[model samples]
Every structure is written in C-alpha cells, then in structure tokens.
Target: MANVYDAEKKVTVNVLNKEFDLGLMIDSYGNTGFRLNNGVFVMGPMAIFSKSVLCWNVRTVIDITPESLSAFYLLEPKLDILVIGVGNRGDKLSPQTVEYLRSKKLGFEILPSSQACSTFNFLNSEQRYVAAAIIPPTNVALNLDEEFDAGYRRQRNLRLYEE
Candidate 1:
C-alpha cells in the first residue's frame, strides 16, 4: 500500500501522485512558528493536518479551546485518531476541551512536537486514517523518522540510566 524507502528511511504512498505528505518537521521558526511540508510553509502556532493542512492563528497551546477544535468534528469520518503536538513539551488541556475530544470517540495521543510529527508521518505514509494538530517547536531541526528514532533512543537511554 505504501512504498518504503529503507535507505532514506522515509515512506511515500502513491495517492494521485500529488504527494499527501503531512510535512516533515518545523523547518524554520521564530517567536511566531512555522511548519514545512514539501516546500510549502505554514505560519501559525497551531495547525491541523488531514487531507490538507489547516493552519490556525493561535499564539499558545492554551488558546486551544473546544470551540477552536470544531473542525475535528467534521473530520471524524476521515480520521480515526488525532495526534496533538504540544509544542516543546506537553501541556494540559481544559477539561471542557478534553471532554469534548473524548466524547467524539477518536483515539488521541498527545506528545512533544517532534514525536507528534514522527507519528503523523508514519501513519500518513501507511495511508491510515489519521490526523495531527501541532504547535511548532522553535530551534529544533528534525529529519522525521531519523530524528524521531534518535529522540526515542535518547529518552530510552535516559530511562535505562535512571533505572
């Protein structure tokens, strides 16, 4: 279903040849942030990636309210899970928003921005029904799967050392 590039360690699915990539990572950023996918740039604090990218003019993670996430309701049929990238670190959501997301019965994984990007890419490449809401992290350069694996290994090593 998906073409796996073992040497490059990236996966590409043959859609309409338009390339439905959910982007790789935050290519460049500033106080305001941005995500880069296939040379297309997105400027914002929050963005939802489905069949297309929905960039939101948010300032911080706290701005993500239930009302702001109404778009996901419409995408319930298209995506089975919605992964949220919580900036450099994870943040707590308002109970109202959390409840609303839960009520929708969509699987959710809240992770750091890099991890979220990695997960989104993996799912998207497999052509799975998935989407992501991400807050771009600043000053971080990631090479999708490689960076993701390295990060995971680093975290794992930390845990092992701690133990």
Candidate 2:
C-alpha cells in the first residue's frame, strides 16, 4: 500500500490501501481479531485509532466505559467521528457516554464490527476524519475459515513467528 499526502488537508492518505492513511487501519478481520496495514496481527479487542492501533484491555462490550474512549477525545487533529464496533452485533452506549461525546462535539456510531470497518474505510478514503474502537467477536469459531481477498495471512503469520 502507498501513502499520498493531501497538502491542503495536511493528512497522509492511503490511496492504495482503503482503510488507513498515515497511521494504522483494519486491513482484514476475523471473528477473533484484526490484521493491520503493517502486517501486525492484533488478537482480541482493538481500537483502530486514527493515529495508532491499540489492543484494548477490555474484553467485552460491557467493559467499555466512556473513559475507555478517551483517546479519541484527545486526538491532536480532532477526529470527526468515532465508530464503535461491538463485535458481531451492534450495542448501545450508555446515556452518559453519549452525552459526554456530544458535549465535546464528537460524533459516534455503534454498529457491528464488520459494518463499522466498512464505514470507517469509506469515510476515511473520502478524506473525512474518522476512527474506530472494535471488540473481537465472542464467537471466534463462527467464520474460522473465511479468507481475505488480499491473501494477507502469509506475511501476517511470518510476522507473528518473528515476534
């Protein structure tokens, strides 16, 4: 994947890879985890942050609190939206959390992880600022054999072994 700089916006865009630009993006995802642009494999819950990809310590949707999403609020360039991927299903956020984000002038949406990934990629590719916080699916065995169109597993496996 290649990065192209949008001088007017001062943001690096991944004209080659759709999901990511200057920082990390969700290259592919399985029920258990997501693969990143740089070939890193992140198992369990993760945040596809605009500036970085993080393995969130929280294990379930119930573990996600407003503080768990503080990083989005602190983003330097100010992300326009934060898409929360609630595993295989969409979940509702607490009223307090929604209110807090609204007060900060931050927009958010809750969707299934798969749909969230698509939304993030589309919005980001259009050069709209966006980010995602996703939880790995609870049912890991559901689609264990599904494959990505890019054949990304080879390098990802190699990197896992190297680590």
Candidate 3:
C-alpha cells in the first residue's frame, strides 16, 4: 500500500506486498466502490463514507501525466483491462487519454455509475481491475473506508505528498 500520500489524499499500493486499505463506496442505485483506502473521499466539497468500515480491492496507484485519473488504473493496469464508472445517466470517458490508452492496447469498458456496483463485481470476476475516479455526486456520497483511520483522519486533508 501507499506509504506516502499525495496532497489530494491519493496513495499507491504495492501489489507485491498485497497491501491496500480496502474501503467502500456506492452509487445512487445502492452500488458500492471499494479500495485499500478508507474513511472518506472528499474532493472539492465531495465526501463519502459508509456507516461502517468497508474494503476495496485496490492494489496500487501510479502517477500519470497531469497526475489525475490514476483512480481507474489503481484497480488495474491500463495496458491490460479497464472498467469505467461513468456518471449518472452515463458520462463521457476522456477521449484524449482514452485514445492514447487504446493505442497502448488498453481494453476499455464503459458502464454508468448507476451500474457500477454490479459491474465492478463482474469486472473483478473477469480479472479486469478498474477505478471510478471521475464519478458523479452519487459516487461522492459513497462511503469509502480509510486505511489509516486516526492518522489519516487527522492529517489526510492536508495537501502534501512524501514522494
């Protein structure tokens, strides 16, 4: 798991170590999102947390250009498979980066957040890891579990990274 967190509260997981926090997140249709990290995912006034602790299957997150959107690949590698969580009513995947991803032999699967929960399970079963970085308000309301509870809760909100 990510020993160092970025200012945005993002972390990198070590698949070799099999280390991750495994948190929970859900969509409007009562679907959930999960990863190794927990607590809350708050970005620009968005925050989500479950009534209890939950876990996601995120292994690690890499730093990409512009340093955003790693949330998707965090679940799987871009060159292998992908499961996209489009916003409510369905949203557009990033055409620019997506084409580049395709050029690199990445397999893209689009699904609305409305169906993210079920789709996530399917993808996991198919061994296609994915992340829903750019989701909707429903996604925000999702309850994510923070790996480092007290430590993170007290310090995660600060904008800083250890590299």
lDDT of 2 by residue, 54-136 (tens): 78877777777888988778977888888888776646667787787778887888887777777776666666788888886
Maximum-lDDT candidate = 2
Sorted by lDDT, highest first, which candidate order results?
A: 2, 1, 3
Runs in model 3 with CA error above 4 Å?
Answer: 1-67, 70-79, 126-134, 137-163
Q: Write the per-residue lDDT of candidate 1 for residues 116-138, one digit (tens) a residue.
A: 76677677767677777877654
Per-residue error (Å), model 2, residue 133: 0.6
lDDT of 3 by residue, 1-101 (tens): 22334445544222111212333343223212233233333332111222232233321222222234344344422424444445444445456656655
CA error at residue 147 for candidate 3, angstroms: 35
Task: Flag regions of model 1 displaced more than 4 Å.
Answer: 1-32, 138-163
* Model 1 residue 11 distance off true place after TM-score fit, in angstroms: 27
CA RMSD for every model?
A: 11.9, 11.3, 13.9
TM-score of 2: 0.66
TM-score of decoy 3: 0.38
**Cα-based lDDT at residue 59, candidate 2:** 74
